[model samples]
Target: MTTPLPEQAKSIIKCCRNGQLAQLKELLSEGIDFQLFDSPLFAPLNTALKHGRWQIVRYLFKENNLPLNKKTPPIIAAAQYSKDNTTGLEIVFAHTGNTEAVDTQDRTALMTAALLGHEKKLTYLIKNATNVNATDHSGMSAFLDAVVNQSLKNCDTLLKNGADPHQITAQGDNAMTLLLQNSTPNPRLIKKLLQQQLDLNHKNNHGHTSLSISQSKHPKIYKVLQAHIEAEKQMELPIFAPSNPIEVAIQPEKNTIKQRPLNEEKTPTKSYSETADDRSSNQLQDTQSKQLSVELSSWFQAATSGNLGLLNKLKIQGLTVDEVDSKGCTALIHAAGSGNRAVASFLIQNQADIEHRSHNGSTALSSAIISNSKSVVDLLIKKQANPAAIGPGKYPYITLAAAQWNAGIVSILADAGAPVNTLDPSQLNLYHNVMLAAEYYSNIIKAKDTVRVIHHLGLDINQTDKEGNTPLHILCGAHKEKAYNADDSQIANLTHELLKLGALSNLTNKKGFTALQYAKKHHLLNTKGVIYSFMS
Candidate 1:
């Protein structure tokens, strides 16, 4: 039977796991050993690292000088445990300078990060000489991990960092075979591997080559592979071959050779026929192009004008509803943006792609939010549109709704599992959205409601952008001399709300300016006073 832990040990372990840094510090200062182990599992440093208690982990490392370069280092712990807390991983990397450290599973920090689709950590590791193609005990390479996880972005990153596409897994499946075997094969990824000139003829353990495996399951991929193989075969063949039996019969042994005229009579006839065929093909192509243009224009007009009958007729006439205009706006996108509920409904019912993004990355749901169409937004969400999808300018649908102050749309999206704390690719958070809303709308009521929604969702009020500026800093730095009239009371209320919601006052931007400093620099006495009161 396993022995039970003492109350003091349990308390210390609890503090580390729950991120109770102050409590942990108090316990450590008293009699609790900083190096106390929880038997066969973890030490205090490991416990803190495992739970992603970065503050506690840092304190133990800096104050106690706890070594991080163990058999299982804190870097691996941070890679495995730190989900959204990338700062902890960065700190561990900065302190240890060991990106290639492996854990008990023989998995390096880079492999762990790639397996979990941690792009930031993976990038850092790649930059620090960590091998991109390192495999774990299971013979799963970081590239294979990214492929199996279906993380296309990570796959691209690994490929760009020189991960071998031809590297086979333990099961004898290379990247191409594994990717093609996926239920929903990423065409882009497959094309990328194809461009790398992976061995299509290489068979797996199942004796299935890329062509043979994809022939039955993935016809599109099979066709692409087939065409490539045929082209390669053609390239391998000699350009000048015997055209007739007479030439073949008169081959190597004969000394005399008969030469044809440079300008044969049949050449002009063949050239004339080829030109006639080209003219016919061009005429047919022109006619088809004109017809397709007219059809697309009519389809777009029907969608934009909310003519359901005309849309139905066009669909009956074989017009693809999901086809985009020059701007990449599909019929559904047009209907959603125009607030034409009936037309949008018809398009959805007719199987229009709900998640189709425009050229600017705007989805149908985002367009509805932009048009302030609550019903259209609800319909799109009901049809299973991704509420967390980023649209034009890298703004999420929820952020766009917040910018419009459409509380109803925000609630709908939130209920549909839209993340309140959704960050952009550049790490812009809800705080950034609040600033964008204030700048774009300039409506005090809308600004207040945006803050209210953010608070209600319990998102990180203290979250900073890449520049390290919090929402408070952004609000304080707003130029009052801009186009809209500055509402002092509204600004004060927003600042007060941020402080009340635990927005840190001492946090500085990259330029070494706090919220109060920004306010003072802008000469906004009201904003400065509010911030000062909070600090005091």
Candidate 2:
């Protein structure tokens, strides 16, 4: 009885998956079928690329010469898988010219690489597979992805790989058009992309061409592109020339209007008056230099004026509202801490982002809490401030705010569903601080307001501090063995008040002793009696 052969295409795909080059070769020698999975096309290659099996990919491509699908290659899968195991990306592309697949999101493997600034993967794909002229479904191309992701190295690689600069987004928006649309455009990147060609009249889906778009969003980049576009137009000959010599002769005056020169040269030839003007200009420049420009860069500024008019002007000028200041605070951060409702309201109205953190990881809402301003805290929450924003001190920003004692602020933060009992990474609870505050204030009245507020809010009355002394333990030891004045009675009354409010009697102090042990150690017979009676 003869053994029937396995299906040839399945066998080849299996060999590719298993890296069985020798068996694959033997089967190929026997005239086995290659297109068994050809209905979807490149399924074997796709699987091999996904797993990043380089040897198998090399075998399928170099040895078997499998057809490489230019439109729907498996490069995206390869890039995604390569995040964990990066060895296969180079091998597959070197072996197969199949990196051209633009995925459903209009994102290609090259675009992904460029977007993340994956220089090696981008270099390999640009060199081996992807066509530079292709734009994704969203009108974004790999070049635009590079700009958005701030991958200058990827841009250089694409440009070196013969990527055409004239490729535009679906809306006819080219890289230059996008550069000008950004509030702050990178001039160097724009110049590099425009080296190939500039499509002046090419309008995107919005009916606005590169020139018009540049003119509106970013004037700095616009000036550069406008000059370049006009120069190109000037160098080209007129398309429609008058046919007759008589007609041409008659049109001289109309054609000679003073069109502005594309590139005007500045020559510095100084006369006496000019020298005086230059000195005056120098003084003005020096004066301007002495005056700190309120327009801080997107990341760092100073909080000098409490006025938010500067913030308003900044937003109008397209500065990031969440720009961190010198102290790592944003406009909203200063506004919150300053308790200036007007400034905070202005920033909120102008779309100031509420969820940004300062250098210390504190948000505007957190700053408001430290300032103890209930109004600021309320405004921030209404603007959807993130309760989880940790401050530079590494706890909830609200934990550091000033008006933290304000009942309304407490309710507002508590109602926002903020984690009330969040412990630090070191397992330190918020109750630890409460215990420490008890130690700072010997007078019951001094600590009564906050304690009462926290207690009423249902904070754990039995929670122990690092020294293992709970609130009850601290209250028992507030006065030592010496006899007290009438104020001593108030301390005793406060203790009874707290106990009635659910303070636990059995919690121990640092020495593993209960409140009774602490009272007995200090020889306070009256206090010991009260604590022991409570324990009983």
Candidate 3:
């Protein structure tokens, strides 16, 4: 690599940053580097165009010959800051047909416009023969972008121009499914797409059809599609007239009119409950026993979202409170995992197990701890959950959780008089737990207090594990920068506390390395010097 003239580079960068087109042109003519600002940090012309300084952008794009694509340029800027009707979009698309110009994400201008909801630009580009179906490297099509933006009109325009309705995105969502999966309601767009004959039955990557996604949120859309499907089937039936078609038509008119008047629509109006009963009867007979269970799963999912009213209604309908799902989780597990105290209390009051374990051998208590649910922890502890229970699956250890510095739950366990010195099934003890915590929490405040707590609880200060490494050895073996700034005063104070608690620090591991040797090599000058200073 060649070294650039520092002063010249500085002046050129300043010109670009300031959008001084005249100065930039003069500097370029004077042999200033044009591509010098190509670092991933910021592209010079990209910054200039982003600020709407078209003059400077033209200088860079035309004279200096800087690459306009592959960086945050005017297009992304317009999408973010420009109003929908602004000319910022026009300037962006002008640079689009340049085969030499590439987008920041290597997407075409059409994709960027659609994805970012630059509707005017998108409309112009698509009309001018910019590919409406262009996909980015991530497989996000222009139509998919419009769907993400919830831009119904833009979607209609693209679809009208032959945007592919069947194109599944990288996430395996076709346009029809993507619209329904949005958390927001887009009924107008759903109606429009249904009118275009896009399949509502098309399943996404998750094996859920558009109808399934809309089932709870947009039931109206579901009804419309279901009706359309039924209508399409009816249309496919043969429409032949009878052999005496004229005679039949003449004979039926009077009787049909007179009978219809006498019957006055005949069928009794069904109440909501009656209609529900009839539907449930048909549903039960169609699929004996399994559909009710699946419906229960849907209710449990609603419970997972903390819909207590829905849970109560389902329970009233005779859905079991203790029903285990496919993953062997109940509403209690979901509530505990989420730390939703209200839902947990509701389940507990309803006699759901507070100590239930899932398929992976994780109990509600374990899930609560992992989720950092302090309230759930308190509740479980109050309900007398066994604090000493260890996960039975692979890597079973109560101490593994301490590595994440899960302070509140650990404090709860410690308060419940659980044995702190309880080793893992592999025989590692609380010191190993503190060491792991310190390694990860080296950057957090009061992290050293954790080590002190372990020591105060009657653990060996220099305890060696099966591999023969002590906590200090592990701390010293960290990255050089980490070792340098590891707050040796904290370690000294911890050592003093250990000594006060009648623990030893001169222990050696299997490889015969002491904390002192490791500290010296890692440039932990403060810690090593303190050790010697204390000894002397």
Candidate 4:
């Protein structure tokens, strides 16, 4: 009973799905309809969003003037398809001010994000005032969705944001009941719910309370619940209020002693008497400050030298773990930047701030990437540091890693939700950064690995910079540079990777020079031959 999509509409969908922004723009300029929906239940905007094509989505909204207040904003689609890169979701949320909009199923975008276990998307939605307890037609709240999907992080986030733990689903299953039915129940989740005082005696649709269900199916957890209930019943807590204010009578008295003459000899100790509290407090403060200073200095050195034992000792002595150096870099930042995994782990275990940015806007995560420390990067990411955090000069942390030609760091960042298409404040894209990497760093393997990561993230290999120079143009220019120091085989391997990623050989720069033309003009015979083969 459905009609087939027109060929033109299919082309629009194809352009959006493939992230062909230029082609899509050209089609739109020619007066192509932007509102056409295809058989897969997607319009041009939703199609781009569904595929994580962020650039195309931005173009559709910014250039095409797409309305964002529809019953289902494009953000819902973006959140549903969100992967490691949540930049698209962030963008849609920043542009569209409708976090409360629901789809036909009465499901908010937060619910969709929670159901899909997209923690970054869920965090963004909850921060933007998306009702955490808002339910769909089935009365399944975002909190319930998180529990059902076994997204422990999302559950913690929802609960911390004031989601009611006792909210029952349309199926009459509360959080406790659902948690008990999990194939493998998480002890931490049960403890957290109990700590939050979730209703232990609440019943489900089958008239079965959490205690009853646990007694039959989950005996170990049932014991935990029972113990918690008994503790609450037997504990007698007291409420203490502040004592009433007391008025003391103050009698006027004569001068206790005569003032000493200016020229008179005075004893140093007899000049003033210090109270016990004042003397002790002053000595304690001075001693603590001196001790803290010594500990912080030792801790900083220990961090850089990968001395975990000393770090732990300092932490155990009550040193501030997050204390920064003169340059405003935390001890964790120093450990991460110096590639000290052991010290970084010790600091993290001791509760250092992983998301703390330095004076220059650099974070421990960015420092780890810049140092080419994969294990440190993984550790920071595991601790939930902001992978997409921007540093000074408005450059994303991944941009710095990509520019260093550090493929291992790039892979780690990609896994931590760093977007491949991040642009710097200077309008330079990842391709540009990669090209710069190839130019400065003669390590062809590193350049190739960086390119591989960019390709894997679904970024366009043929994307041009502000100068209209494709990555091919930059590579050809690099081949001409004597300082590049890359041999013919290395250049050939780089060329092959770019070609594999669909880099166009015939694309020209702003100077009207194609890659082949640039290579031939530079008198780089080997590079010219490789370009010819790819172009032909």
Ranking by lDDT: 4, 1, 3, 2
TM-score of each: 0.45, 0.39, 0.45, 0.45
Global lDDT for candidate 1? Answer: 0.69
After superposition, the stretches of candidate 3 with alpha carbons farther than 4 Å from their true spots are 1-147, 150-168, 171-300, 392-401, 441-443, 478-505, 520-536
Among all candidates shown, the one with the greatest lDDT = 4
RMSD of 2: 27.8
> Which window of 10 residues has the lowest lDDT sum in candidate 4?
248-257
In model 4, the clashing pairs are none
Where does model 1 exceed 4 Å of error? 1-288, 478-490, 500-512, 532-536
lDDT against the true structure, each candidate: 0.69, 0.57, 0.59, 0.70
Minimum summed lDDT over a 10-residue window in model 3 is located at: 248-257
Error of 3 at 229 (Å): 44
lDDT of 3 at 428: 55
Task: Write model 3 residue lDDT over 80-168, tens digit each, in one string.
Answer: 43445435455555755431233656566566667777778677666554355667767787787887788887886676555765677
Clash count, predicted structure 3 = 0
Model 4, global lDDT = 0.70
